[model samples]
Each structure stands twice: as structure tokens, then as C-alpha cells.
Target: MKAPALEQRKLLDLQAADNRIAQLQHTLRTLPQEVRLAELQRDSVAARQEFGGVNGELEDARAEIARVEADIDTVAAREKRDRERLQASSSSKDIQGLEHELASLKVRRSNLEDIELAVMERVEEIEQRLAAITARRDDIATEERLLAAQRDEQRDRVAAQLEVAKSERSAIAGGIGAELLALYERQRERYGVGAALLQGGVSLGTNVALTESDLAQIRAAAPDEVVLDPDGACILVRTEESGL
Candidate 1:
């Protein structure tokens, strides 16, 4: 393979751009906000379940309270009717029976009121729990929105960087001759080494120095010539810094 020394140097820039693209792609795939969003989904489900349970219990408590109040009203009405009958009747036996029935109704009404009070207290507790659960859900939603906004912003920045890198690589590739470009691409695809700097008799690709015979061979080649290191990993580009 033969390429001008100047053309060979541009391979470093192309390689760097390719590395930038790879890095940006990796960032897009592993954003931290994505992981947090997944966890929030699970948290949302658990919160919903707890809220449903508490709400159902509150409803049951309300129904129980209504039933108790109804029972109290019925007992009060029965006592009023008994009192009316006792005042109108002159018979002693009827008056005595009415008094006993009225006494029983008062006891039943008192028990129903107690039951209603207890159930109202329970309903208040359940309502407090539901309010707490609702507040937690709101917090989670707010966090999710914030994280999502951050994720989108980061993704846009990374995507823009990737586009710029690809454009730079394209511009560099356009300047190189077809034969040289093909050779560089082939070496890169085959061994992940497209070009290496030949400095002080060393190939940067493998970070190894050449032997006496190998140095002699490269020294004999033309200044415009392109050569590979003994390891044959990459095209070695030389300059005054090569210390030839």
C-alpha cells in the first residue's frame, strides 16, 4: 500500500472521530435517568395498591357509620310513639309497659351513637393515610418529570456531538485518495489499526522498537513510501520526528 506521508497523518484524526462516535453511542444507551425511571414505575405501582386499599376501607367505614345513624333514628322514633301512648292512656298496666319499652329504646340509641362515633374516628384515620399516599405519588411524579427532562437534554447534546464527529470524519476521508482510503479502512477493519506513527525506530501501533535489519529496510525506502512495521499491524507514517 502507498500513500503520501501527509495523507497518512490524517488517519489519526479520522480514528479519533470514530472513537468519539463510539463513546457518544455508549452514553445514549446507559443514561442514569433511564434506570431511575424504571425504578419509579415500580414505585408507582406499589403506591397505587396502597392507596386503593386505604380508600376501600374508608368507604366501608362510611357505610358502617350511615347504618348506625339509621338505627339510632329508628329507636328515637319508637320512643316518641311510646311516650305519646303513655300520656293518652289511663290504664296503669299500659303505662308501665310503655315506660319499660322507652327505657330499652334509649339504651339501643346510645349504643348506636357510640358505634357511629367509633366508625367516624376510623374514617378520619383512613383519610389521613390516603392523603399521605397521594402526596408521595405527587412527589414521585415530579421527580420523574425532572429526570426525564435531564435525560432528554443530555441525549440531545450527545447526539449533536456524534453528528459533528461523523461530519469531520467524512471531510477527512474525502481528501484522501481512493486507494489509500481503501487500504486504511481494510487495515482498520481487520486489526483495529489503520495507521501508526514511526518515531525513533518504534511503531506506536504495537509500541515496539524495530530490530537492526528492519530499520535498515525502512531506511532504504523512499521518503514518500508507506511501510508497515515488522508486526504488520498498521501503516507506519514517518516524518522528521521519526528520527530516521
Candidate 2:
């Protein structure tokens, strides 16, 4: 198709705007904030798991301490009953038996006290662990929130830039003839680059390494003209040099 010279120049601007839009899209997809937010979310989940485990352990420890204390109270009550029974005994053999039972009760009470001490120590340790885990979880939650906000802002900015780039690309494309624009769009879908400048006789399109025939065709085209073919090749002439 024979587009006017002015329309042909607009093709270059269209190509540039399209490239800019593509770059913006790439930046949006691969933003550092995207990766960071993913990692932060993972960490937050892990922190929550840790906090849950710690809380469960603390609860278990507390329950265990309560159980041990109850057992101690029961044992002390039995010892008191045994002492009262000893005081009421009158026979020598009975007195002897009562003294032996009282000695055993003392040993049992010592053992219960030891167990209670150990349980208390465990409770203290669990409390400390729960506190630490809760603090860390809170910190991670805060960081996740901050990162999410920053990521949202970054996404908004990228979206705005994308809209602007799209508008610019559309305006430039509007300046070209419909046939040329259609050809360019088709080539872009096939090759990822709609048109490339014939610089130094080289047809460069989104890192498209040109074949010999492609190079020859570009070299043969008149300056400042757009060329298209069915093989998804689109070239814009810029110079007579045959080696670009």
C-alpha cells in the first residue's frame, strides 16, 4: 500500500510508542516489589505458623502445671488425714505402723513438690517463648502490610504509565493508513515486532536477526518507505547503506 510520506513517518513514532508500551508492561510484570511482596507473604505465613505452634505449646504447658498442682493438693490432703489417724491410734504396733506411713507420706510430698517445681519452670519457659513468637509475628505482619502498600502504589504508577503509553501508541497508529496499520499489527502478532528501521541495511525488530533475503529486500527499498510481506516481515527504509 502507498501511504503518504507524512503517514510513513508516523509509522516510526508508532513503532517507538509500541516499544515503550511493551517495556512498561515488562517492568510491571517483573517489578522488584512483586517479588518482594511474594517473599514477604511467604514469611508472614510462616511466622503465623510459628506463632500458632508456640501458643499451643504455651497452653499445653499451662494445663500441665494446673494438673500437677491439683495432684499436689490431693496428696497433701491425704497426708493430713493420715496424720490425724495416727494421733488417734493407741497400740504400740499400730503406732509403729502409723510412724512408717507418715515417713512415706513425707517422701511422697517431696516428690510432688519436685514435680511442681519442674512444671513451674516449664511454664515460665513457655511464656517466654510465646511472647517472643508473638512479637516476631507482629513484626512480620507489619512488614507485610507495608510491602503490600508499596506494591499497590507501584502497580498504580505502572498502570498510569501504561495507559499513557497506550494512548500515545494509538494516536501514532491513527496517523498511519489502515492497511499499513493492519499489516503492522499482523506482523507484530507473528514476530513480536511490527516494523523495524532499515538501519545500515539491517532489519532490526525486537532483536530479530534478519536473514540474507530480509536484508536484501530492506536494502532495495527506497528511503523513508514502509515495506511489508506475508512472512510477517515489516521494514521501514531509513538509509541506502547495505550492511546494517
C-alpha positional error of residue 66 in candidate 1 after TM-score superposition, expressed in Å: 2.3
The TM-score values for the models, in the order shown, are 0.79, 0.84
TM-score of 2: 0.84
Q: What alpha-carbon RMSD in Å does predicted model 2 have with respect to the real structure?
A: 3.3
lDDT string, candidate 1, 168-197, tens digits:
889988988898878878887887878778
lDDT (10s digit) by residue, model 2, range 196-239:
66555445553445677876765566654566532556645353
